[model samples]
Target: MGRQYAVIGTGAIGGFYGACLQKAGLDVHFLLRRDYDYVKEHGLAISSTFGDFTLPQVNAYNQVENMPPCDVVLIALKTTQNHLLPHLLPPLLKPGTVVITLQNGLGVEPEIATIVGETAQVLGGLCFVCSNKIGLGQIHHLDYGQIQLGAYGNNHQPQGITPTMRQIAADFEQANIPIQLAENLLLARWKKLVWNIPYNGLSVVLDATTDAMMKDSYGYQLSEQLMREVIAGAAGYGLEIKESFIQKMLDYTMKMKPYRTSMKIDYDCHRPLEVEAMFGNPMRAAQAVGVAVPQITMLYQQLKFLDARNIAIGN
Candidate 1:
């Protein structure tokens, strides 16, 4: 008997990864919202840089109560929908279930820890993939599909690599998805923000993609400046993010395919942007330690205003 997996939100992250796991012969059950009926009947289609494939039959469910308890549960929902976790998670928990949150921004694991309490192991998965749900039951993978897994610690300290992390890594590796285990989850979260903050936010505000931003002089310099501020903010928590990492991120974006960020997509769709998770929380964290992130603060304010107006106008 192999490990049974449950994907809580089968959007881009969950749908792509869960489909990969299932294609590799792993038992992956997907819990969907809007796409449940379509996927349940027609299955999932994935077009990726690695290759294109389809799952003709998926263990799809619309409600968690109808799904079986699994060894691993992947939560891929937007942080904004986290309020529903209390109702959606309990039914899928048995003993010793490993709940990995494939969400962006800070304070995710802590919130999950409170929900599951001591009943399950909490891990944070920082996904570095550029994917989007192009249509119902369809996911388009643009570039860079790798995940870094770290165990959540008390007060967001370093937990080091653990057996559970290795166990889950093996599962993903078997599915041909790249995995890296982090010694410090907090540091990894901040490191992800170094890329996410500038790219995701600026994509919406500037109404451009990565290529547009990287190619223009103003966009490029502003991105570098924001990256530096994020690096400085991380230092307030005693986390060392090397100056060279900024160039690495910039270089990565330069080579990536022209792509709209998840935040930008949300904004364009009139959906709520993850302003708080990606920007608000990071800015407040920096301010807590007296680290001033004026640029990040300004970006955060811009995003909040834009996000609210976009939703209110329904456009």
Candidate 2:
């Protein structure tokens, strides 16, 4: 009778965190896709730098319609699969269901808001984790596992940190995952782009890991320029991204392990990249405010071509 939790999209992000929540003794149900049968029989395995564990038997299902309504729903699906939400969310939501999206990029909470309407309290969560599903029902957590939480209001306005946000944060804290609340979801999205725009783009375009980008002089400089463009874009939207944050992110990356970005991995696997949500929208937002982002625009155009080709090949 603890919080009834449901995890939609049980891939790397969802699988890792959902396993953590379930291990913490919550009534967590996993709505899996391709790995549903494997996980249901063999359980989910997590290999983490902090620790390693496995759930011997998880409440697993393959369809939303079969899952019971839950008090909390963690949406960890890629934005590319968001079109399924209007059909996927209704059966899993009750009167006070709290929906938290752990996906990247901007404008996600607003999109979910439109689907769930007033029945659920939707929130945005930025997960700072380097983890991937290395095999069927297995997640390898390489490094970093902090979460930044923010409340989403009507029309996607920033509602600051509410008591419900605190309650969710407390739940995560009990599970040993660090969580921080952001005052504004939009500003938080912009801040995360300070690191994501550079590494996620360059990693795919240049075919390099994060350390490789940081070690090479040219790649390092281009990364800095991309960061500056993001800062300028944020400023154009009236969100001041301080100059020091660039160096702070650089230093942080320099200290972490050499990592392949999500987009880079998607490209390697021939899955669709999140170019529109991550790069295209930000570029358009900047241009609307009369700010020029030549570097970001270039990156968006290149990624657009690459993504389209991937889709074509898939077809």
lDDT of 2 by residue, 80-190 (tens): 898899999999999999999998988788889898998999999999998999999999999889999999987457798899999999889888999999988889999
Error of 1 at 311 (Å): 1.2
The root-mean-square deviation over C-alpha atoms between each candidate and the true structure, in angstroms, is 1.2, 1.3
Number of the predicted model whose lDDT against the real structure is largest:
1
TM-score per prediction, in order, is 0.97, 0.97
For 69-172, candidate 1 gives per-residue lDDT tens digits of 88999999999999999999998898999999999998889889999998899999999898999999999988889999999977887999999999999999
Model 2 root mean square deviation, Cα atoms: 1.3
Q: Where does candidate 2 clash, by residue pair?
A: none
Clashes of each: 0, 0
**What lDDT score goes with residue 255 in model 2?**
79
